[model samples]
Target: MNKTDRLLAIVLELQRKGVLRAEDMAAKFETSTRTIYRDIQALSEAGVPIVGAPGLGYSLMEGYFLPPVSFTAGEAVALMIGTDFVEHKFDSDYRTKAQSAREKIEAILPESVSQETNRVRTTIRLLVTGETYNSGREKEGLEALRRAILDKRKVRFHYSKNIPGADGNRHSVRDVAPYGLVFAQGSWILVAYCDLRQELRHFRLSRMSDLTLLEDSFTFPTDFNLQDHKPADDRRVLVRVQVHPDIADKVKGAGSFFMTQMEDHEEGLMATFHVRQPEELLHWVLGWGADVVVLEPESLRNRVREEAAKMLKGY
Candidate 1:
């Protein structure tokens, strides 16, 4: 392992054990006693509190404490579920990080609850096989962009919109100051300033190519609201529909279409969504077998009727 990896591992290991011997640490790291002492010295200089005697070995200074952190049941479940879900993200390296995180959690958590959690999670597998995940460049760009946002710094990147041309080819490249990265429908979106549009635009991360971070910085608009920029459905097309009483329970929770696939909803559930287009919603409504029907906004019903008639002729 490199210096950073070794350093982080040492801290985690120390955190695992209240105390450790310098000789044992050197043996564990396959390094000499002097090197281990030097490493300990570097860690102390770098903010880790190490205190002890030579014969008694060393210990992270007693009484030193990290901020107390608490997790609610809801939060814990959410984390496990989120991590399980993220396992499918394309060619993602976060799986290793996820494993390390789970280990850390299991290490600190009450044995009984943690064991039960692991029992179920072990049987669950999320595979993103045959999927082209976010390219490494996109991931790096996103990481950099996120760090910049946290630091309130600005970044410049070479961005290009995958806009189709009259001949179905990609349009010219564009420049962007990435603002945020969002995942929708298992696809990532990079929300940024499109210099070509001279305004805000969202680009599909999977389609973005040639990303570069510029040293330029920006201040978010004082009145800026990230939530408002992309509602639960940004390209949402709302349409009223009549669903059967049998499926009414499904409507009780209008799971976010952009965030989730409405896993709890029953079949034939009629719901309104701001999708890319009206036809897409119509197709969904029709797929609910016969229990679903269009109730309001005559325009949508008429379009469905037209499509149905056309389909009937074919049948």
Candidate 2:
């Protein structure tokens, strides 16, 4: 491995093992102990917070955090692409934070790696067209919600439902114990336990206003695992679709989180997805236009036809 790469690997080894001997590092990297000593000296000179004891080898100083480690060209490009997506697609407040982080990554990268990363970044593009998220109007609410989630505090907010019920009151006050924040379907959703509803609910950050972090604190449930928790509307239907060969990869990449199975065919790619709602599948299929065909679940096909007819009528 290159010396620069090896130096970075040594830092990673020290981090993982808390301490590493020069002999062990040499054996792992297939280099001489003399070379390892030189590398250690170089790293210490470069302000890496490395400390050595007489017999204990080398380790990072306690409480010293090495800024993110070096990245390969491909990894750097991927990070830039992902941050760019978040900068465009996420809330404005988060977009600024993501941009700041990307700048830091760029600033710390070695010049050679930075140049190749820039080359790859220029060659790759992620285009987000159409109105995916609300503008930055909900910045305060989102920030408050995040703070509440982090502090394990209850929050009170007035929410204006996109569709009001028969009572015709557009807004209602709710008290919830914020558990997690989820970014999905182009919106920030607060996954919280609603004191009023007496159950967990998802509240769109955009629809929330007049948010206040309550002084009252709550204990998060020990058994509540965010990864395993599903939204209340978690009923799924298996929907199949045929994707045109030209755009199959794009479709799969975008929907990889929800797609269950895919098979390559002569004409195109056949894909099955466990979709929570037909509207979600409808919107996705419509985005592909003629490049995608909904093959099963008559309900989804009919919904697509109905929505397409409405679009045609508008034109």
Best by TM-score: 2
Q: Model 1, 246-303: lDDT tens per residue?
A: 7666554544452223222344455555555555566566565456677656776787
lDDT of each: 0.63, 0.83
Q: How far out, in Å, is residue 72 in model 2?
A: 3.2
lDDT: which candidate is best? Answer: 2
Please provide TM-scores, in order, for all candidate models, with all chains considered together: 0.48, 0.57
Instruction: Kindly report which residue stretches of model 2 are placed more than 4 angstroms away from their true locations once superposed.
Output: 1-10, 13-70, 89-94, 129-140, 159-172, 227-233, 236-315
Every model's Cα RMSD, please?
A: 13.3, 6.9
What local lDDT score does residue 52 receive in model 1, on the 0 to 100 scale? 72
